[model samples]
Target: MGTITQFHLAFPVRDLDEARHFYGEVIGCPQGRSDTSYQDFDFFGHHLVAHISGEGRPLQSGRFDGEAVPIPHFGMNLDRASWEALATRLKAAMVAFHEEPHLRLKGKPGQHVTMFLFDPSGNALEFKSFDDPEQTFIP
Candidate 1:
């Protein structure tokens, strides 16, 4: 792959300290510059900023592979090993999963392992790994 560009996302969180602990300690993202109102993290090479706000968007659900998934979630697609490692880490930390880690789309073009969870501020995040990386965009 050529020079992949990093994406930036700024989202709301209820508290800075809670965001710090979750993104830094639980998720293992190296923190960047931060202040009383916002915190930045290196989310798998992408830039993620957690800004303090009263509350975030309301929760909604959508269906995927016969499962209910939170709408408007964000996350990264990792290789198999990294995905498994993160899953193990989250399990050990006892983070409540919005959707348990499991393989979906079996025998299909985009077969993959996936999991979902919410941050302390209720922002949904998903982590997944395609069985065949090349099939990431397959319809």
Candidate 2:
């Protein structure tokens, strides 16, 4: 197999401490170096940094596969079991889901499990997993 690369993402947050709780505790992201202004998180295998962008940010949505998806959302792909565990955690936390968890492309080439939710900062995130990992890139 070829080398896999991790990506870095920096997004807005209303409060640093709240961001810390959401990303660190809620989402299970391990906390990294942080200052008063920004903090980095281990987002599954990616680098995610949250910056204090103040309050009352607008949320946008788009349609995908007949479902309303959060515009400009970020997330990761996991195996089925990991995805379910995270889903349970999010539900136990009473995290408000923009779109409840469901299956998409059912009985098709790219069938998968997906769910969407937002952080306290209002940034959207979608976590999904495919029945067959190899179908991920299929058209």
Highest TM-score: give the candidate number: 1
Cα lDDT tens digits, model 2, 1-139, are 1222344455667788999999889999887656565676877767566766555474254344666555567776677877888899899999888878899978877688889888989877878777876555443
lDDT of each: 0.72, 0.71
Task: Return the lDDT, model 1, position 86.
Answer: 88
Q: What are the candidates' C-alpha RMSDs?
A: 12.1, 12.0
Candidate 1 TM-score, C-alpha based: 0.58
Estimate, for each residue in 1-139, the C-alpha lDDT of model 1 and write its tens digit: 2222344455667777999899989999888656555666877777566766645543255445677666556777677777888898999999999889999989977688989899999988988777876555333
Candidate 2: C-alpha lDDT = 0.71
Error of 2 at 114 (Å): 0.4
How many pairs of residues collide in each model?
0, 0
- TM-score of model 2 vs. true structure: 0.58
The number of the candidate with the highest lDDT is 1
lDDT of 1 at 85: 84
